[model samples]
Target chain A: MQKLTFPRMGESWRTFKMLLEDLGNEVVVPPRPSKRTLDLGVRYSPEFACFPLKILTGTYLEAIEMGADTIVTSGGIGPCRAGEYAMLHHKILADLGHNIKMVVFEPPRFYPFNFIKNVYILNRARHSIRGIIALIKKAWRKLQALDNAEKLSHVIRPRELITGTTTRVYRKGLEWIDQAYTNEQIIDAETAALEALRNVPQNPEAEVLRVGIVGEIYVLLEPASNLEIEETLGNLGVEVERSMFLTGWTRDNTWTETTEGMTVKAAAEPYLPELVGGHGRDSIGNTILCAKRGFDGMIQLAPFTCIPEIVARTILPKVSRDYDIPVLTFFLDEQTGKAGMTTRLEAFVDLMRRKKHFRQGNGLLTG
Target chain B: MKAYLGIDVGSVSINIVVLNEAGEVITGLYLRTKGRPIEVIQEGLKQTAESIPPDVKIAGVGSTGSGRYLAGIMVGADVIKNEITAHAVAASMVIPDVQTVFEIGGQDSKIIIMRHGIVTDFAMNTVCAAGTGSFLDQQASRLNIPISQFGELALKSTSQVRIAGRCTVFAESDMIHKQQMGHQIPDIINGLCEALVRNYLNNVGKGKEILPPIAFQGGVAANVGIKAAFEKALGFPIIIPKYFNVMGAIGAAQIACEEVSRKGETSFKGFQITNLPYRTGSFECDGCSNVCEVVEIFEGEKVIGRWGSRCSKWDITGENK
Candidate 1:
């Protein structure tokens, strides 16, 4: 059996490993990306590469050390430099003298022969094509369930009476989803997770500010990369509306069109009509939608030196001005300090809270 | 007399302020931090305590600035706030209808937009802090002039020269080149001030509507050349508050006042803390490769509080969570 592994991509690692395991491969899962992983990557990768690139490189190295014989991950294409990540990672690994196999998964519709070879030949899928299709469908459902649980946590965390309750419950919810094998079990797990989050002792009357989170998909989805921003904001009494979910991202990236694709594009049409590269257009579109929906504020996150998000960030001030919604664009990198991020987040939330108070009261808050 | 005390321990300076029940500044002291925040804060408190009336009771205490947490625990602050909110509160209190606030401190600069006494939007210098007060301070000393006289020298300039303020390295090199070409020192300083102002507005003040009646505070506001450059750029004369150097402390004091009035009790540890022996120490936590540098506050061998951990595993508060 080919020892297969994939780089950590947010919380999807658990579900992804399960999918690979059932597909007739011994999955070698690396520990979730942490400081050690980041340091390992930074030591080898180019100094000015995108944050995700360095992180992914480190993850692959750790997986190799853990006995992963094959690395599998999707490829990207566009103005963003992510399109070259797999090639560069492979080169870097080879230069380090590790002769492991690297499989770059392209969209099946566009690269059918390569897809079949990866699935049926190298991966050795034990089931019929139809059965494999059903398995993928099941995995997709599980992922959707996990994403749902995560979204629910964003809503429940702010109102939770006991600090850290939502975080514990969310972890339990992920564990349940991971251990689930059947479709009904996945559904039950999601229901149970949401139910537990709802059952968390909470002050429902807690006034929460709605803030939309927009930016590069990697930073948005990866908890470590963004430093558990969602949790931090939630603990500070802000409800977050994440711009991208894996389901929507998977759908849009596949040959099939997504329901959210046209809407996001149309929303971004007035501000940024063309795709600058990598989620740049979508970020602008989501900010506009948030403004129209009357969100109190939105914070844009991007990797340091991220071109696409930088392009989006430069145009965001106009959007913030025209819509009367506050926008805070922040970049993430190795040097980003927890203290600085906390101060900014606290100050932004305070600004929003004071703004709301002022709008609700007529100069009565001067006290 | 009931009073609220605010302590601002920043990267370069420590400011302590006391406000009366009417929110008026009773005593304010600004002292150089010199990389020792703990000692400076205690000394500042001692100085303020001595300057104020003996009967002025400190009803509440608030801490702010970068070292807010450290200062908060040491002084038993009722409210620990970020610098932005503190500055906004102080600005609006001083200039009732203040529309804009420009705060240039030691390591960072920020622009706050306000409407109807509320902060609408704000931006801080990120990634690159090229145009902050520390940079100006360095340039002034490099020119063999005291920082206090750097601005006055600039105001005496009779010519204009362009200095690259995009990066500090480039700005310093350009200043040297201008000096080699025999450009007047006053003109060069004036050019540097204008360049710094342009960079600040372009970077931190980008896309924000900088309306008039702006209030310029923070330590950097002491530079008249920077003030002139700001006026030239925005075409509006900015008002420097009475307690410009200690505005952050004033804001923290006001916020504390409001908090104590609402809660009907104070958490003030009082002027006695200045007489106590307090120390801060940090150690790395080997929790899952994060290696978080957890800082702990101690009072005479007793651990008082711990912070700076990502997972918050080391967030110990002595007897309480």
Candidate 2:
């Protein structure tokens, strides 16, 4: 049997990658996603496909074309359409005449059998303790770097002129971390990149409006999914506070202590009560939290066929009413374009500015 | 004297309820949405306004449902709540000890679990159309039977027939196969009711700790066949409130009454809102990687509302204020 390995991006990705590598397989480390990678993903994927689908599909296809096989990915089994993506991708690959064995990591409640099967696969990997420790350390370094880079970007990008420079350096740093053999080397590369990026000049006239970004996790992270919404907001003179991040997501799943033992419910309870069958809980939580945190407004981004976000759409108006905050939900898919979205954002920002001015002038008279 | 108004706008139906200062429903209207929420709401409001006495003043308005926001804006709602909270409130008002709520509406279904008059847990099905009223309406039309009489006909079944109700496609095919196998119409109808009940139980009601005193509302509650099926399956009589079809509206109205009495004011735009020109359109925002499709709602030429934004960057009214 041929051995195959997976590249870990965050927490699970690191553990899984190590387990695979320890199994004595030729591991393929996918390049950290950059503008080029996302562009490739968008170009190759079907229009109207979810953002994550486009990016992951691009990664898998790119890896495959690079002579890699035995793809492993996580699986979900709820009302959300995400769980079915793996199977659909598998079929797509098979129909394209690619003979690859796609392994899916399932959630505990949905597929108990898959849990045992995953354990068996991990056990097959010869290096039990040593390999696991190495992977954990590598993953920690990567996560810390990514988190620091994202946080710094948020602070530095509040001004306009230096935004592009920071992003460029950040991407380069990620690439270096991915290729780094030693943890110390990875940390050093990340710090050096951050320092260089921070040296760029920022716009003095940028008006920072605290904006909240909410919606499906993949679309929120993958620039391709949201059509580079965060970047656009940054350029438009708005400070984007994204509600989803790799660190929070991992904490919600793997580390119960970090999440205060609330498990899935704890992470989701603030947004939505019980999984409304999709990212509905997240949407609800983000909306309420954004309002409570005194965010000027919130945006909900999701795919067209997303059931959970749709449910969130129905409930958001109520949230808006209760908090007296305005929430706009954006549905994305393959067919979304740039020009129209920009116009809308321009109009929305203009409206917010006008309202802010009015409220400031009139005190309590305006709507 | 204060009054409260509630509006429930669903995909298939629009329900309006008016309650007096005492929080008792005085007049109610239920109309089919017929795929036109804006139009139906307008007509329903017009009719409701006419039915009410001129002296009866609306002190507060509340809205609930998938279309709650739009309805809230149109009616100048003081409170907007989800169907779960609204239903629980209405059910508790009538059946104080109501432990379960089985609400199957036109396009969706929900199971509300209550303990001592408070909503403890709830589950809703917005994706699947298997157990919804729209499914029953489609089946009734396919069978060339009036929807109103379809439920009664289902109750007349003498023998049981099995019909797959997991999905609409599977259920329709199963029904055709059963009909071809010489099963009686009532038996097939009974089978469908059973299948729908079974599907709901397996999907929405799965692992739910259902207690007695279950109240079945929503449009599907009109179906005696489904009621019998539920009773047969659960071995307990599911109570259907008097305002079965408009419980959400009733609940909203009750909530409005409470809200206004506490606040001592009304924000209703009045029945004149019917004359307001409202238009909606979608546009993709290409500000960055998050090319969000923003939906803009305009009143005449002015953009009154904007939604479908991934970042609150678009809607100005929601920005800082």
Candidate 3:
């Protein structure tokens, strides 16, 4: 039996596991990144690697301990160091004397003999190509449903009458998604989750500050990495619209690359003409779009020492000045204190609120 | 007389202030925390009670700084705010048209940019402490010079030598190297001030427009050498507020006044809290991987508030449940 496992990412890990299990493979799902995972990862990995790399290093190690022989991960084709993550993980694991197989699914543009070999290793079930396509399509549907459910919860969270109601419903929704064994189960889970989210009582009379979050993908998606910032903002009565949802990010990569997510590229092109690697371009572009859409402010969350985000951070001040919006850039690391994060976020929210009120007052005076 | 009490409990010092209805300072006191906040808070409250007349009534209370939550719950604060907002509020009162506020305390540094009485943007130093009050304090103590007189010695320097202020380790080594180079003490201290100012501008004050009518406050603002270095860097005179060191408490007092008048009631726990034995304890909740440390506050055998847990299972204060 070919036992398979993958790094734990956002909620997409559930769908990824379901896809592998449907392919007649035993899948080991690593537990969520905890204090132990972080400590172990930091102990082994270079101290300078970005937080995502460290977290992934920890996740893969946990999965290895859970009895996995093969690791399947994606490859990137950008100036960003994310492209080298899989190779780095392979080397780091090997240096520690664990000789397990690593199946790297590179982007389609670089498809060659290695890609074919990796594919052959993955086809342990020996299913037909059409059967594989059908299974992949099934997994993609679940991905969209989960992202939509999560997106809906964001709108309801800031306005929810009772604190933590949206979070509870969303978590339960993910559990239902996890329990899915077929297409019907996925639909039922998504519908029930969406219904529960809408059913959350909200204060319609309350006004909320609209803030846009743009940053690196991992920190944006993972709650543990960013310290649950999306939920934190929502509870503080701010409507958060994030730029990088896995639905769009995954849709634009690999063999199924499409023009759907390229709009962010165009949006960011005026400020950052070239891809400096990572999500740097996407971050700038999203901030411009958010400003044009009349968001009260913008926040960029980057892992500490992330080269691309640091490059984007320099250009962001100009974007803020031109767009007439306030931008707050935060670097995430293990040393980041919870109290300090809350203090900065609270102060930023207060700034946004005051500026918004001043703008409205000016509008009323003139209009 | 009616008074609004404001307490700022920080890492190094605790400041207590009483402001009357007109926002005039009736009394202000400063005490060292010495790593024992509970004892320091009770001592400060007791001293304030003793200093003021018996007829004077504390109509409202507020708290700020890193220990704001603990201080707030202990005294039943009407307003609890972060150090940034509190400092900004206090500075605006001193310099009404203040465009920029530079605050460097013991453990952290921050820059607030304000336009037309609204804070437009702000930035705080990262996890690095190479450019804060504590940085100077450590160097002063190491050099056998009192912190109060360190700045005066720097002002008497004739020549300057640069020190790397990006990290404390590098800066300390660089200072020693300059010392071995046979440079005078005053010149090296002056160079250290400039290095700290450079680091502060490069990090905390990065991309911030430091327009004039700038107010520099906090514990570090007491250093005339740093003040001069700041002026040299920006080419503008900096305004040090009258209550530069205790501005957080002053701002808290001001905010307390506003909050109390608006609510028409005060939650000030009274000076009698000094007599009550308040106990605080913390435990590690191994519920999951997060390993959140939960803190509980007790008032004479009765649990008052509990927080610091991610799951909110043990959180009694709705702060982070």
lDDT of 1 by residue, B11-84 (tens): 88899999998889888898999998888888888888899988898999888999998898888888888899
- Clash tally for model 1: 0
Q: Model 1: per-residue lDDT, tens digit, A1-367?
A: 6788887877888778878887878889867788888999999999999899988989899999889988888877678888788889999999999887888877665777878887775446678888888888988999999899999999998988877889989889889988898889999999998898889999968989999999998989888898888888998899999999888898887777776788889998988889888999999999999999989999999999999999999899898888888999889988888788888998998888877877777443322
Off by over 4 Å in 3: A109-120, A255-260, A362-367, B318-321
| Cα lDDT, all candidates | 0.88, 0.72, 0.86
Q: For each candidate, what TM-score against the reference?
A: 0.96, 0.59, 0.96
Q: What is the clash count of model 3?
A: 1
Per-residue lDDT of candidate 2, residues B1-321 (tens digit): 567899998888899999887657889889998887888898899999899989988889988887776787666788765566677778877788999999999887888776655554456653467879988999999999998988899899999898989999999999999999899999999999999999999877865768899999999999999999999999998999998889999888887777666678878989987888777788988765446678777778977667665544675322211
TM-score of chain B of 1: 0.97
Q: Indicate whether candidate 1 or candidate 2 has the larger lDDT.
A: 1
Candidate 1 residue-wise lDDT at B234: 91
Candidate closest to the true structure, highest lDDT: 1
The residue pairs found clashing in candidate 1 are: none
